[model samples]
Structure formats: structure tokens, C-alpha cells
Target: MIEWFTAVQVIVALLAGLICLVLGFIGKQPNDLTLGSIVLVELLLIAQLVVTIVAPTVGNEPSGSLAEFYIYLISALLLPVAGAFWALIERSRWSTVVLGVVGLAVAVMLYRMGQIWFVQGTP
Candidate 1:
């Protein structure tokens, strides 16, 4: 995985988390802006998944366990979707809080994926 691209994902995820948290604190459900941020993050994750799949064919495999890395990747990809679904169902400020938690988790998982890509024995 590309370091710079992964860093961008991390930053975006964290920012989204912060935004959701702030909105929740202010007693608001997720609005379009928050939903848009989540969508943006999911798009970035899909791009990363494509890169991960193509990189190995181009001889750019991860240094760490590929299985573990893939698990993280798949989990990261699904997180936002689940969170968004829950948020929609709940339709409350707490739903935004759930999204905030999901965003932060995605950020951490992305960072872990980077480590798995570049650092050996990272599992």
C-alpha cells in the first residue's frame, strides 16, 4: 500500500470521526455533510482495496501475513457500511455517535494495514 495514500485515508477518517462526534454532542442526527464524509471514506477504502488486489500482481505483496492484512482490509471496508445502516435505523444523536466510533475504528484499522504492508511480523 502507498504510505501517502494511507496517510490521507487516516486523516480523512479521523476528521470524519471528529465531525460526527461534534454533531452528536450538539444533539443532532447525521446530516448530509456527515453522510457525505462517510461516503467519501468508503470510496477511499474501495480504492485502497483495488490497489491491494492489483499490487500483488505487480509484485508488491505485504511484508506481513497476507491473510491478516486481508482480514483487516475487508473489515475496514465493511465498517462504514454497517455504521451507516445503524445510524439510519436509529435516527438519533446516538446514531451519530456510533458513526463517530466507526470512523475512528476505520482510521486505526487503516493504520494497521499500513504497518502490515510495510513492516514484517506485524500480526
Candidate 2:
């Protein structure tokens, strides 16, 4: 639940989402750029998963519901994989749009995860 790492995730999601969105708008099919963005996001989420596991052991335990935090983290981890598979199967501009949507969705979910882990129910 490190704030700086969460910020980095959010920024990456936003930039990838916006770029894919623009590509889709221009009628581009799911290309390397779109797929690469998903790969990057998935890698970051995997790293975040590791951090989440280690953070508690290091005494950086979450301030809010641990169950909720895990749920968000797991869901965020799945989005990019699913999006990439969908794009590979479909191979259309809409596939690129799906990537964009997943990126944006991950960004929002990450924001909420940060809240649940650090800021929720605190004075």
C-alpha cells in the first residue's frame, strides 16, 4: 500500500488508456502498442502483488479491510489478461477499445485499492 507505487500504477494506467483510446478512435485495430501496454500493466500488477505480500510482513499493514483490499488487487490483476485475450481473438478496432477500457478500469480500481489500504476509516 505504498502511496508512491500506487501513484505510479495510476499514471501508467491513465497514459496507456488514453493512448489506446486515441488509437481506437482513429480506427486502428489492436496492434503491438495496444497489446504491449497491457503487458506492461500486467507486469506492474504482478509486482504490486509481490509488494502486497511483503508489505504486511514488513509491518506496513493496511489500515482498512484486508478482504476488500485483496479483492481489488486480484481483480485488477485479471483485467489486463482478459483484455489481451479478448483483443487477440477479436482483432478489431473494438479490441483496441477494450484495451483502453480495461486500462481506465484498472486505474479507477487501483485508486480505490489505495484508499482501502491507506485512507479508509481513518481519522
Candidate 3:
């Protein structure tokens, strides 16, 4: 895992999380802006997944435990994908809340990725 990529993911997730929280509070119904932001965050997660795959192949294996990395990698992509789909179907404030949780989960996953990458004998 690249520190730079994980850092970017964390930053984008934080911004998206903040936006989702505000939208969840103020919106009458979930709108495109909220949906769009959620999609963008999902895209970032996909990028991270790609990097995670390529990095190990190219000799940049992180230092974290494999189990943890696998869990984080899978969850990072799955959460937002599922949340966005659910939000699309739900069409309510709950959708925003779902996105918000997705954002938060991605951020936590990034932090986990960081710990895994840097910790001794972990990856």
C-alpha cells in the first residue's frame, strides 16, 4: 500500500463524510450532489484497491498482517458500493446517513491500511 494513496483516500473520505452529514441534516430528500459525492468516494476506494493489488505484485507489499489488509481492502470497496446502491433505492435521509457511514468506514480503513503498511511484521 502506498502511503500517498492512503492519505488521499483518507482526505477524500473525510470531506465526503462531512458533506454527507450536512446533507443528512438539511435535505428534504437525498439529491444528486450527495449521491455524486458518494460515487466519487467509491471511485477512490476502487483506485486504492487497484493500487493494493499492483503494489504487491511490483514489490511494494505493505508491512501489515495479510488478514487485516484483506479485510480492509475488501470492506473499503464494498461499503460505499453497497451504501450508494442502498441510498439510490431508499431515497430518504437514511441514504445520506448510509453515505456518511461509508465515508467514516473508508477513513477508518485507510488508517488501518496505514498501520498495516508501517507496522513491523504485520503485512
Candidate 4:
């Protein structure tokens, strides 16, 4: 995994999360702008997933233990997609809450990813 990409994702996730909360406070539903932000975050995550899959095979040093990387990758990749679907199912405050949760999770995963990447060469 590219540490820089993971860092960028984390920042993006945090900004999205804050937006979700603000939108939720202003209104109980997500507006078009909120939806657009969600889509952008999803695209970035998909890109991260693609790069992660290719990194190991392309001579990049493996980040952390392989098992850990895969676990984080799958969960990080799933959260936003699932949240977006769930958000559409209910156009209420809860939907925005879900988005916040997903964003927070993505940020946490990015931190974990960084830890894994940096710890690989340690004894």
C-alpha cells in the first residue's frame, strides 16, 4: 500500500465525516452536495483498493503482515459502499450518521494501514 495514498484517504474521510454531521444538523436528509461528496470519497477508496491489489505484485515492499493488509483492505473497501447504499435506503438523520461512521472508520483504517506499512521491517 502507498502510505501517502492512505494518508490522503484519511484526510478526505475526515472532511466528509464533518460535512455529514453538519448536513445532518442543518436538515435530516442528505442534499445533492452531500451525495456528490460521498461519491467522490467512494471513488478515492476504489482507487486505493486497486493500488493495494497491484502494489505487492509490482515490486512494492509488502506493508506489514500480508494477512493484516488484506483484512484492512477488505473492510476499508466495503464500508463506504455499504454506507452509501444504506444511506439511500433511509433519507433521514440516521443515514447521515451512517456516513459519519463510515468516514470515521476509513480514517482509522488509514492509520492502521500506515502502522502496518511502517512496521514491516521491524524485528
lDDT of 1 by residue, 77-96 (tens): 99999989988888899989
TM-score ranking of the models = 2, 1, 3, 4
Candidate 1, residue 93: how far the Cα is off, in Å:
0.3
Clashing pairs in 4: none
Structural similarity to truth (TM-score) of each candidate: 0.95, 0.96, 0.89, 0.86
Strongest candidate by lDDT: 2
Local accuracy of candidate 3 as per-residue lDDT tens digits, 15-60: 8877887879786356787778878888887877788778878998
Candidates sorted on lDDT, descending:
2, 1, 3, 4
1 or 4, which is superior by lDDT? 1
* Cα lDDT tens digits for candidate 2, 9-95: 999998889889999989999999989998898898999999999999999999888888999999999999999999999999989
What lDDT tens digits, residue by residue, belong to model 4 across residues 1-123?
Answer: 777787788898888888887877766686676666667778887897788778878887564686787788788878888888888888898788778777778878877877886665545
List candidate 4 stretches off by more than 4 Å.
120-123
Better of 2 and 3 by lDDT: 2
TM-score, candidate number 1: 0.95
